[model samples]
Target: MMESTSLYLSPTIFFPNYQNMLNSFKIYMYTPPNPLSFSSPTESLFFSSLRTSPFVTQNPEEAHLFFVPFSSNLSTRSIARFVRDLKLDFPYWNRTLGADHFYASCAGLGYESDRSLVELKKNSVQISCFPAPEGKFVPHKDITLPPLERVTHASHAPGNRTARYLGFARYNGVKESNLLNELRNDSDFLIESQPSDGMTLVGRLGSSGFCLFEYGADISGIGEALRFGCVPVVITDRPMQDLPLIDVIRWQKIAVFVGSSGGVKEVKRALDRTCKDDECEGLRRLGVAASQHFVWNEMPQPYDSFHMLMYQLWLRRHSIRYARREFV
Candidate 1:
């Protein structure tokens, strides 16, 4: 698909102010906003990444995918107006019923606020961080984006490896409180329940062999762990539905998966089997390799998050065939 890959972004949605809206988060955070804490950087990263891809085309006729790059903060009425105008001005939306079109949003709360937006969800690829099953997130059609943090190659620090087995930072979810209590009592693990700064959290993740990933929270922690070469021990009841880059990364090869029930026992078993010197080294290698897929570069790189998202759209495009329409 890369040979002839092309995308046309709707001009109405890709306005000058749209870029300013995406970059606005940087004005307040000083640094890139943590993908784990807020949606702003995630939105901005995806926008900037796509903007630099070679596949982006000004001529709509050569395009395979049509992007509607709208922010989550846009009013539902404004979104509706854009769609209405696109349908009137361009034949692409009507020709494909928006199946060839897609949009990304990081604000889960904003999407849930407007019911009228459901029509858009039904038709286009809704790339989002929250892939809640009940929220009209069709797993087969939609894409789950990884919460990306701005990291240079030097972000990960080397130390004497003072920390041990596993670390759970800032975990206060009531549903998993029992498991947290169990792990806290165990001497093998480090559990931090209180709020902490970003550097502290990154240091904790870097030092530990494994990091706990709680379900229903920002899965960007998983990305952070991967970045630091820490194996992620996922705690979830269901299968990992929202894992980013699932299309490219074989998650089981690099990370541990455990059920919510018998959480301590499961985590302990995973750690015992995988945290040995040889096995830990292998997982670390895999994590470092997989980390390349999660990063966003100013210019699209091979196997980076931008190209991976494009690859996802390419896969979706091949799933169904559309008859070519001759424009009069």
Candidate 2:
């Protein structure tokens, strides 16, 4: 429902170089999702590397999309709290996750699948992001952002801070080899094997086998590594997990389980039990199966031709999906 304040368009609209123009597309980011908190940098760097194709529109109303502010869930007074604690900011955000606001403009097209876009029993889209062409943002090569420095110390130590698990939320049990080497070099801690390259699972073992809670993937992955599997020797909180594909799997089963407050000895003991148990193998197999859901090539970006098609489809329906553009 928010309106745009800018009446002018950028010169990129008329530029001959499609890539330059696409990169110049002015996007109004409302609340940026925390790159440190997310499972991987895919969401953060994905858009920055986008290069618009010839088919994509350049107008602010068409090319520029506004991310819904992460403020809808909190009170106006708590806006600062949400922004500070969650590391989110909605300086010029135009859309929200609300279906009503995006039904007409195609602004919310990438959001979770709904009746307005498609008919699905349950909301198929959990998270929404920009779409782009392949090789638009190559990991390690084009990724230039500095590592997050805020999550260095836990309130409690599990004996080692050098080792970690990586994965997006829910999709668990993946680890990278480089991470293990980083942790092994640390003299302060004993070496532990990291999981395969992905998110590790964490959960409570009960009569039903595993009762997983809604914890972040990063936390769960580390717990899983310490508690059960070790695909790596050292642990570093590196960008490991990408956005997940399937929705059925519980994150706890694949993640490494850890307590919020516990001594290193306790963590060691739990790891001993998990490493020696037969259940861990079954969990590992499940994790391998679950991993098939994510295909890195499928992520969206600003350059992909598919994005343009989706926009045109939405436009035909005659909807108000976007807000006007502004630079500041």
Candidate 3:
């Protein structure tokens, strides 16, 4: 008789939009819209506990394993950041790190609309981590955008229209803009300063740090305004899919995503579009479904508990463990 051997599984191919894919998963787990609390015991477990059987005395191994795993070592917020960032490695991780395994991370509530998560879930293959209290720094570094400054050049200006884009970066697909020219021409369009006297905010911002830009509003503040029923507008060269908004916010409804070519006119166009769209009116009709689905409130969701289940699944399916190994 000959002995048989099996090869360990290879890693999954990485995708550029891996984060987007994961966002979809997070959206799914968050769907049907339920309130989440970072402090909830069931939410933290990510898996149902094995209860004692009537006659069986043996401890159940099933409860010890799950498809997604939560962290005992990190808080829900930290874990949430970890998963959001790890999306870049999805393809590689999916195949080799282990099979049929997932991790549920968590992050602070009130960062963005959880409803956005639901939208993503309906379309992608990723998952959201656990939930946490609102207001904390994400585990990953903030995406840097050009700082707003008074333009001295002639090309950076436009008449009465300020050209503003947040989180602009060449690598991330933002086109190089002539800020000076835009400012010079748009004298009527002032770059809204961070402490704007009366301007409205438009996007999510990183927590616990001095803001990167000098004017207008931070991303978080923008999301806050949206929650309060104020429509927000964001300018970017890349897709808003990665931002705190996206599927949940509805492009022309409640918010706007401005592309590089879209200038002040674009903002107005977005605003105009938002006012006419009737799709979102039904959001109010969903009742608690609309309110709870994918919307994060003061409380966090069951992200961590879900991640723990993933971790357990990885261990059992692949004979691996999380965070117990080290190299000297």
Candidate 4:
């Protein structure tokens, strides 16, 4: 484990009104999970990260950010009801209009059709796995979370690699994509929509020189590929925002991006152009370097998913000037 570095928060930016807010940065977790409902692995990991962090405080008065850990998998009405109750109990929501609050979800699909929830979400920060389509995800306010997947074994070292070309385990959203058909027809391409088991998927990614990610904003596959030192080939129709930790990680050095409009020929050209042994090795090393940023640790570590999420919040918090408001 790498030693955690001391994080410096500028007093001027972090606490414009309150001088004590700099080193005393605090986060208050609202609404504990029900034993019956249970949190997903990602959600569980996030909560675990918060529990281990030194910044979490039981007192809401000292908090810099209020975390609503409600699962987005629930109905929008359920989430809205929770938010309504929160507002009734605390003055924080009304004061900032939800700007200082945040919630995490695997995807923002639940609140899309709900007008009330949509309006509320626009004011709050949404940390999500898949970037919502237009009118849904506000890039500057919301965060794109890297999908968290556990790696049981250390990735194999780069050497005389046997795997060649690109591969994919699933093809749900991109079935109609011409690139999918093109890669399938090409004799040199190795693509799989279904693997025999989890290990088989890992094996395919581990051996493959490049892994195909066809769906837009899906980082789960990208996470797995990076873990195994396989370079990711992202093919998307939508605008790809900077992958998580864009401020620190150079994604272009580790992955290939191909526009979906370019069709199969373009994708094939990219694969043919970049899958050379030397290029693959360089991508492998860069991927290894960037992989640490995506990991979710039981204890909050430097640049781990937890700290990265906090860092995103830190950036947003520094940008906004919070006025000193007295709450009774």
Best by TM-score: 4
**Local error of candidate 1 at residue 46 (angstroms):** 1.1
lDDT of 4 by residue, 78-107 (tens): 777778788788887767767788877655
TM-score of 2: 0.29
lDDT of 1 by residue, 1-328 (tens): 3212111122243234334333321110011112222246766777776665556666676667777755566666777767766767777777766777777766532353343254466667777764343454666777877666634545553555555656654565445467877888887788765336666666677778788876675456666677787787877788765567665556776788887688678788878878776877677666766777677777766667776676666656542434546544
Global lDDT of each candidate: 0.63, 0.29, 0.29, 0.66
Clashes within 3 Å, all models in order:
0, 48, 68, 0
**Compared with the true structure, what per-residue lDDT tens digits does model 3 show for residues 1-328?**
1111111011132222333223322111111112333333333432232111111113223222123233434544544444444335333222323222333333322333332232222222232332122232232211111111121122111123222432221111223245423532543333433432222222211110011111122343332332222233455554333332122223333344555365545544554454455532322122112112223312323322222222222223332322322223
Arranged by lDDT with the best first, the candidates are 4, 1, 2, 3
Q: How close is candidate 1 to the true structure, as a TM-score?
A: 0.74
lDDT of 4: 0.66
Candidate 4 minimal-lDDT segment of 10 residues:
1-10
Q: Write the per-residue lDDT of candidate 2 for residues 200-297, one digit (tens) a residue.
A: 22211111122222232223232333232222111223333322211123444453454423334443454456556575555554443333322122
> In model 2, which regions exceed 4 Å deviation?
1-41, 44-97, 100-247, 275-277, 298-328
**After superposition on all CA atoms, what RMSD does each candidate show versus the true structure?**
10.0, 18.3, 18.1, 6.4
Better of 2 and 3 by TM-score: 3
- The clash number for model 1 is 0
Instruction: Tell me how many residue pairs clash in candidate 4.
Output: 0
Give the poorly placed runs of model 4, Cα more than 4 Å off.
1-24, 32-39, 109-119, 131-135, 156-158, 166-176, 197-199, 217-219, 272-280, 319-328
After TM-score superposition, the amount by which residue 257's alpha carbon in candidate 2 deviates from its true location, in angstroms, is 1.7
Clashing pairs in 4: none
